[model samples]
Target: MKLQQLLSFTRKAVDEYQMIETGDKIAVGISGGKDSLTLLYALSGLRRFYPKPFELTAVTVDLGYEKFHTEKIDALCRELGVPYHVIKTDIAHILFEERKESNPCSLCAKMRKGALNEAVKKLGYNKVAYAHHKDDIVETMILSLIFEGRFHSFSPKSYLDRMGLTVIRPMMFVNEADVIGFQRKYDLPVEKSRCPVDGLTKRQYAKELIHQLELDHPGAKQRMFTAILNGRIEGWPVRLTREEVKSSS
Candidate 1:
């Protein structure tokens, strides 16, 4: 997708969920990947003319990997005129060398988010923007169902009361395919992940499963996303009509 298309989808999610407010400072969690970089581009574009004025900062928690560098990301942030911060941590060593975890994605994610949240708080940002998109939402719901025997997916907006932080996924309406297209079209500086278990996780399985389902049954992904929107899942934002959105804006 182009930048304009990305902004439209992002603004839709933000408006529907009321994610941003006047004078709100949001930290975009940058992982140097396509999804995160696409989010940075979307929010940077949205910040220019969205009715509600807000501030944005790009943040990444470096997991102490030798090959994982942020030079390109820093340059991109500079190009976008957003402040960039990298929190250095020994999470890589802890997960791979010391613990040798067979299934490290869960622990790695927790450690990464814990570090990211703390940095965001210290940076005085009240909200954090995650890059989870439509595919991620459906895949997560499928993962929950197949693994935990439940039908659940994360809300577009969630409050972490204990940490005093609000997490918002602004690209909830953007598809993963569109993200890839945006990255390629814009020449996004994507830093490849060096993690050993990058694509061997259950989430990867769910993603592939969804891809196959979509191939067999056209529009399956859209149906699942629609179901999630209408399922009345706990913490989901109430759907707003086009009239309501116009009046509110």
Candidate 2:
């Protein structure tokens, strides 16, 4: 995907949700991964030309993985002149040792989120932005439906209780494929996850299924997004309005 396309996509999501405004202090969550790195770079680029007043600082939650590296992330932020914070927490050890669970992706994610929330509160940021994209939302929706019998997915903009900070997904409209493409185009720094049983998790299975469907039928994934935004609720595990149901039916 071209940089111009990414600009328009990111602008739309931010504009629609009013995520950035005059004098807003936003914290971009950086995990030293492709997604977060791309997000930080995009936001930084937008800042130069954006007609509003907003400040962004990079923040990372270090889970104390044995092979994980924060140096690269630090160098990027430093090069960009963005202030960053490294939260030192031994989440990986807790997930592996205490839990003793073979696959701890879900728990590990929750712990990371909790750490992020706490960090936001401590740092006094008005908004916290994550790198969750369209694919992550789709996979999460499916996972929630199958496992919890719930219709829940992360919103582009929402309020957190403990942190009392607005959580925003500036990349909500971005596709994972596009992100991967951007990574290739821009050559952003990325680190491999140190989680040993990473692909064994159920979410990985969901991701593979979604990937296969996207290959089998082009526009199938886009239609799924359109269906959700268009208010069709059959595919989702949630209550639906009569109008939405009739419109789809």
Candidate 3:
């Protein structure tokens, strides 16, 4: 997708959820992947004239991988004029070598998020922008249903009272396919994930299942997204119409 198209979709999500506020400093969690890189670009561009006057800081938590490199990402952040910080941790070794746990994704994710959150808090950021897109939202709900026998997904805007921080997903309206297109078109410095279970995870299974269902039932993805939006799931913010936002502000 083009830059304008990406920003438009991102702004739709932001405005609907009131994700960004005046004088807010947002830390963009850059995982060096396409979704995050796309988010970085989207937020950087949004900060140009978003009217709310928020700041952007790019952060990456390096998971002590042997071959995980982020030189290109560092350059991209410099080019965008966003302050970048990398939190170095031995998470990879802790999960794989020290603990040797069979299911390491859970622990690894917790550690990664913990590190990211603490780093953002120390940097004086009030909110953190995650790159969870529309596809991620539906896939997470599906994963919860099939695995945990529940209907749940992450919210667009969630406040972590414990950390005194807010999590905002500005890319919640952008599709993963569009993110891939944007990365390719813009030549985003996308980096490969060095995780051991990168593709062999429960989430990947849910993603494939969703893809198959979409194939069997065309427009199924769109309908599923609509269901999620209207399902009244807890913490999922209600999307306001343009007129509603205009009048409210």
lDDT of 2 at 208: 89
lDDT of 1 by residue, 1-249 (tens): 889999999999998888998999999999999999999999999999999999999999999989888999999999999999999999999998999999999999999999999999999999999999999999999999999998899999999998999999999999999999999999999999989899999999999999999999999999999999999998877877788889999
lDDT of 2 by residue, 1-249 (tens): 777778777876776556677788889988888899888887887787777778889888989988778887888888887898989898988978887877677788889988988887788878888998888888877787789897667667777776689888888789998999998998888988777895788888889887899899987777766655555344322333545543533
Candidate 1, clashing residue pairs?
none
lDDT of 2 at 7: 76
What local lDDT does model 3 show for residue 147? 83
The segments of candidate 1 whose C-alpha lies over 4 angstroms from its true place after superposition are: none
The digit string of per-residue lDDT tens for model 3 on 54-144 reads 8899999999998888899999999999999999999999999999978889889899999999999999999999999999999999988
TM-score of each: 0.99, 0.88, 0.98
Pick by lDDT: which candidate is best? Answer: 1
Model 2 compared with the native: what TM-score? Answer: 0.88
Candidate 3 stretches greater than 4 Å from native:
none
Q: How far is each candidate from the true structure, as Cα RMSD in Å?
A: 0.7, 5.8, 0.9
